[model samples]
Target chain A: MTTSQNRSAFLSGMLAMLPVTPGIIPFAMISGMAALDAGMSPLTAQLYSVFVFAGASQIAAAQLITSHAEPLVIILTIWIINLRFVMYSASMSSKLPPSSIPKALQAYVMTDQSFAICAGMFDQNQVPYENRAMFYLGSSVIMWLIWQMATGVGIAFGSIIPTSWSLDFGVWLCFIAIMIPGLKDFPAIIAALVGGSLALALHGLPFNLGLVIASVVGIACGYLTEKKLSSNLPVKSDNDAKERFQ
Target chain B: MSLPTLWFVILAGSLGTFLARYSFFWLSGRKALPEEWIRILRFVPPAVLAALIVPGVIAPGLETENPLFNPRIIAALIAITIAWKSKNVMATFAFGMGALWLLQYVETLL
Candidate 1:
């Protein structure tokens, strides 16, 4: 890619991220409050925002801590909640500048928003793979700064946001926004039903271990069934031409 | 504030991030992610979500001393329906929260 193109892509990605900036602050603040409510100190909460910017997983982990769930269970839940990132990171690894950026920096900046913006461009195949990492880093740095400030605000005013209002629902809304759009096929439908039912059935299990089991089972069912099910769904072959196969 | 809990979140976050970030790099070099794994990963969000939502909606105040018909659940359902039909976040939040407050107001009437 030419230097001009690189600058253009970077500029576009950053611009696309601007609209989501206003939401990030409150989201992090709510998460910070969750950390505090779960007995996490202010410093710990801020550090969590700085390091682990995965918002949903942080709340899930904090909830487990408040319940005094087993440490392993808490860890396992965090892992499960974050498992999707495995796909994101893998997709991005090839796109990164393999030598200039160290593994540590890549790990830190790997996040949902970063991955989404990067992947959207990647799917378009406009930007070369080598420059994708810088695009991700640029966007992630901005998000990270927003999150840190939001978390600090939440910690500073942990007293104000009335628990009764349940601002935490924003996280749920965000997750739903992310999840619902992806449910565009039969496998996803089956996965959601089967996974949700299994989770409900297993809720009595200690330490929220049931969540892990249910998610795995749901994904397994979805995977095994998608081929037979999605065979009938419309599919397009290439971006150059719009031809649908049924 | 405890040392153990503090260390655990940090260690888990760092290790989790590293493992997730690297998993693709290592795997993509050899072969495409098996169709099964890809399909499986697709369900993670729903599964995690169900795990999160069902408890809140169906069994709110499970740990609270008293459990009853929760207005929050009612509001959530309404919100979800709005979210589904419209796919609007602001509408979902407004209606869901509005229902909760509205229901709470009705409860006082009875």
Candidate 2:
């Protein structure tokens, strides 16, 4: 792709993430308030926002702290809630081209919103190989900025936002909006159904392990289904997917 | 939840999270992921998304009680259709939130 095309890819990356911003604002605000309610100094709250940037886990940690949960329990809970990131990282690493941006920075900026957007783009080959990293960076950096700002707003103004708005649900809507496009195939459909069903059945599990278990089992189910379906077909190599990214 | 302990948790949590995010990238390094693994990973986004979205709508706040009466179910179904057909985020949010607010409003009257 030309420089102009790569530039457009970056712009598109940012544009794609824009819709998810509304969903994130309320959550970040809540994270901010939760930190304060847990008795962290404002500086430490901001530090929490900066260091452990994962929203769902951030709030979970705050609640854990407020309840005087053990430090190990808090870390373990956040880690469990975030194990899905390891899967995303496994997937994203393959899509990522070499970059001057440190791997540390890349990992730090990575979020579910960025992962979903970049995953869709790379899988569809809508962005060229040279532009994939740039595109991913574009989406992730914007989200990092937005998250920090939203947390700051939350910290500055506590409980001011009404629950009546149900803005939290926007988070799910954003995921659904991006995810619907990927459901055009059978394996994807199976994955979603099994995953959704298992999550509901196992939602009672401790520390949100249900999500982790559901995701793994659902992926395995989808994988096995795909394997069985494609048994008669020729084996497709990783290069084919890599070529698509190119 | 002492002062030092809170800071320690923040530091420790930060370290753990970064590891989770960085795990595969660090291990895989320059190697291309195996084909089998790639195939499995293809389902990651879909499965995870469903796992997240389904609970948020059906159970809302992780409440495990029977959602037989929850309006969120109806709102989510409408949103999913709009998301699939229109492929427009704004349209999904507008109609989804509108359906939800409308349903909740009607519920209050009854």
Candidate 3:
């Protein structure tokens, strides 16, 4: 594709991702504020946001630190929360064509929001396969910028925001919005139900270890459900032009 | 929380996360995973998201003396409906927060 075409594909990616930006704003701000509340210096909080770059995991780590959990425990908890990234990374590998960009840089920028958005675009053929990586960059790079800016603002001014406002709850609301619509197939629905139920049952586990066990059990349920039950939902043949963004 | 420990958490956590994100790409020379792996990975987002969100929404109710009814759970139910109907982020967020605040107000009156 021409450079002009590449530019537009990138722009389309950014536009598609625009609607989802609001979801992360609360999350980034909350994560930033949580770090500060946990007694990390501004520099440390900012650096944590930048380097860790995963909102849920960053917040989880900060909470662990506050309880004076062992450093190894903190790291492992972060890994467990982020374990889905292994799936995301594997899935993303297929979507992204071979590129000149270093593998490390690509991995660092791969986020749940950008990955979900771009994957939907690719599946719908909204953008050319040739430009998949470019579209990904368009979606991811902007997300990274926004997350950092929001985190910095959160660190700088998040203290002023009243806790009673319950802004942190918005993150869960965002995830719900993204997740429910994707419950198209039987396996997907089963996965969600099993995962949700297991999580609640295991809620009292220490260090959020319940999440780890629940996710594994949930995914297994989904896989087994798919194998046992053929999808009854009729397959659509690219007729619906719904732009399933974030 | 010590200087050394703090730095270790950040640096080591970042490295571990990077590995999680990079695991597949670093291992695979091909463009995609085997079809079997793809089938399994498809559920990753759905399952993981469910794991993350469900417990979070219920926690407010769980924490209170009454596990059956709470502002957060009610608000989330409203948000779930909004999300299913419109699939719009702003709509869900707005309605969810609105419901929560309204319920909290009613609770105050009660």
Candidate 4:
């Protein structure tokens, strides 16, 4: 691809991500405010946004910190929550060419939005394979900057926001927003309901292990449900059902 | 958690997360994850988020007393409706927070 073509691809990738930006602002703000509420200094809060860059995991970490959970629990929870990235990376690897960018840097900026945009564009042949790296960079870099700035704003104004407003609930609301969209199918609904109820039932478990156990149960429930459903239907390749879960 | 412990968690968490993100790229020769794994992994997000969210709304902090009257539960009910109907993140927050504040105000009057 010519330099001009690469630039255009990059610009288009960035522009495509514009619609997703507003949705992310609340999450970024929540992360920042949660961090401060959890007793982290403004600098450390901002640093979390900078270093972690994944909003859900950052919020989970902040919540665990504030609740005085063990450090191992906190770390394990964050890692488990982020395990989806393994699937994302694997799905993206075949599409993204080697040597397009440094592996470490590429991994650093690989986010849900960026991965979605790039993968969508590539699948639709909107961006050529050779130019995908440029496209990925364009989308991810802007998102990184926006996340940092939004988190900074949230940190600056977190204390000013009154407790009467009950913005702390916004944290759970954010998770609800993320979760509801994923409940498009029966198994997903079952996973969420079972997982949630199990967590509630076992909430008193020491060290917050209930969350981990519930997650395991929920995944198991969903997997079994999917297997049962698929078995009843005609056999299909795994790829055909891949999009069903996501 | 202590300062050093928090720092260690952050650093270690970051390392683990980055490795997960980098694994496929480093193992490009292996191709994608097995189909079974992908199918199972698909449940992770919803499961984890539900596990995290439910307790917060219902038995927040694992309180032993009645949780039915919790403002968060009512607000979450509203939030889930908005999330399902609107599918707008901002709308979910606005309606959820508005519901929580209103519920809290009502409790104060009682």
Candidate 5:
């Protein structure tokens, strides 16, 4: 691609993600507030936004921090939560140009929003493979900048807000917002129910291991349920079910 | 956690997350991930969120004696309803926080 074409593609990618900014603002703000409530310094909170970049995991990590969970457990939880990115990466690998973009840059910029935008573009053949890197860079860079700035503003705003306001509730609200959307299928619903129940039952586990155990059990139950359901179905209908699950 | 420990967690977490993101691209020449693995991974998001949110709602603190009939649980139910109906994050936040504040207020009144 020529320089101007690359620039335009990048610009267009940024514009495409513009509408998502409004939704992201509240999330970034809540994350900042939660970090502060979790006893993180403003710098560390901002750094969390910079390094973690994933909202849900950051919130989970902040909650763990507040409870004084061990660092290893915190890291493991965040990693487990982020394993979805591997799926995103796999899906994007075929669409991204093989030889041009460095793996590091691609990995650094990989995010749910950018991947969604790029995946749509790939589906439409809107951008050529050569320009996919520029497109992704544009989209992800804009998102990254906005998230950082939003988190910074939130941290500043959070520090001034009195504890009487009880903004900490925003964190759990954010989690609820995220979780409700993913309850689309039977397996997903079962997974959530099992996970939630186990989390509650094992809430007294030392070092906050209950959350980890619950997550494992939930995923296992969901996977097994999906497997059993798929196995019992006829061949043609099984394919349809698999597609729906995907 | 100490400052160093916090930094270590952030760094280690970032590294692990990045590896997950980089896996397919870095190993493009290798065999693809199994279909079963992909299907299983689909459950991770909801499951993880559930595990996290359940405790936050039912037993926010380790010392909480009662897990039910709390402000957080009530507010969370309201938030879930809004989210399910509207799928709007902002709406969920508004309703959830409003319900929480109102519940706390009523508790104080009684």
Candidate 6:
């Protein structure tokens, strides 16, 4: 891509993240409150966002850590929460900058919102590879900065945020924002139904093992169905599921 | 709540988060993930989300489990239905949170 084209792609990606800012505000606020509720420091909470940007995984890890859950258990839960990122990463790797873009930069921008916008750009075939990375970088920097700021807002004001107000609902709203856009196929539909049912049925399973099991079973069902039903199943790419998400 | 404990949580949480994010990258470099494993990753989001929501929307307390009639869950169902039918994020949030608030209030009255 030309230099100006790269700059425009980056600018457009930043613009895309602007819309998601409104959704993330409350979620991050609640997370800050959660940190206080867990008796954690603001620095620690902010650090969680800085080092580990996955909001759900951060919450899951925080809850477990406060409860004195085993290290292994906490690790497992975070892994499960972030498994989706593998899909994101794998999808984008082939379309990224060839060499000058460092692995760390590639890894950092592999977030849900950034990946989505980047993938969307790619899908539309509007930008070249070099520019795609720049776009993702621009998008992710905005998201990451906003997330930290949101967490800061949460920490500074989280305790005062009223439970009665149900600001916590924003977390669910954010998930919906993430999920709704991808409900595009039959297998995804069936997997969601079946997987959701199994999860509910197995809700009482300890240490959130039910979550892991349900996810496994659900993915298995979807994968098998796709393989059996789709006459032209695409060959498995070099990247695994986790790679795709990352 | 102790200092050591809090530190433990932070350390554990951070380490856990880092490992989870970095693990697949390291593993994928060494060997190819089996095709069977790739197939199973598809259903994870639905399953994990269900696991997260079902417990909270059901009992939110100790003792016996509740069923479909459970008000919190029923309320969530309403929200999910809105989400499915409308695919409107703001609408789904409004309905789901609205239902949860209403249910909680009603339960208090009873």
RMSD of each: 4.7, 5.5, 3.8, 2.9, 3.7, 4.4
Report the error of model 4 at residue A68, Å: 1.1
Question: Relative to the unseen true structure, what is the C-alpha lDDT of residue A183 in candidate 4, on a scale of 0 to 100?
Answer: 78
The 0-to-1 C-alpha lDDT of every candidate, in the order given, reads 0.67, 0.75, 0.78, 0.82, 0.80, 0.62
Error of 3 at A120 (Å): 3.9
Is 3 or 5 the stronger prediction by lDDT?
Answer: 5
Model 4 lDDT, residue B24, Cα:
87
Cα lDDT tens digits, model 3, A138-173, are 888899999999999999998888888887677678
Chain B TM-score per candidate, please: 0.76, 0.66, 0.75, 0.87, 0.85, 0.63
Instruction: Find the candidate with the highest lDDT and give its number.
Output: 4
Show pairs that collide, candidate 1: A90-B24
Candidate 4: where is the Cα deviation over 4 Å? A232-246, B61-68
Q: How good is model 6 by TM-score?
A: 0.80
Give candidate 5 misplaced runs (Cα > 4 Å): A124-130, A232-246, B61-69
* Clash numbers, per candidate: 1, 0, 0, 0, 0, 19
Q: In model 3, what lDDT does residue B74 have?
A: 86
Order of all candidates by DockQ, from best down to worst?
4, 5, 3, 2, 1, 6
Q: Candidates' DockQ values?
A: 0.44, 0.48, 0.56, 0.62, 0.59, 0.36
Candidate 6, superposed: residue stretches over 4 Å from native: A1-7, A66-68, A228-231, A234-246, B1-38, B61-71, B106-110
lDDT of 2 at A226: 87
Model 2 clash tally?
Answer: 0
lDDT of 4 by residue, B1-110 (tens): 67888789889888989998898888885865877887777788889999999988777533553454677787899999989888777788889988988988877776
CA-based DockQ, model 3: 0.56
Tens digits of per-residue lDDT for model 6, A148-195: 788899889877767886656556554554454444566766666666
Q: What are the per-residue Cα lDDT tens digits for candidate 2 across A1-246?
A: 567876786777888788667767766776888898799888889989999999877876786688676687677767755665776777788788887668888888898778876787788888878888878988888899889998998788765757797655655665676567667668878988998899888876766666678878888898888887875544332222222211
Which consecutive 10 residues in model 6 chain A have the weakest lDDT in total? A237-246
lDDT of 4 by residue, A72-172 (tens): 99999999889888887777777876555787788888887777667766778888777787888788888888889999999999889888677778889
| Comparing 1 and 3 on DockQ, the stronger one | 3
- What's the best-to-worst order under TM-score? 4, 5, 1, 3, 6, 2
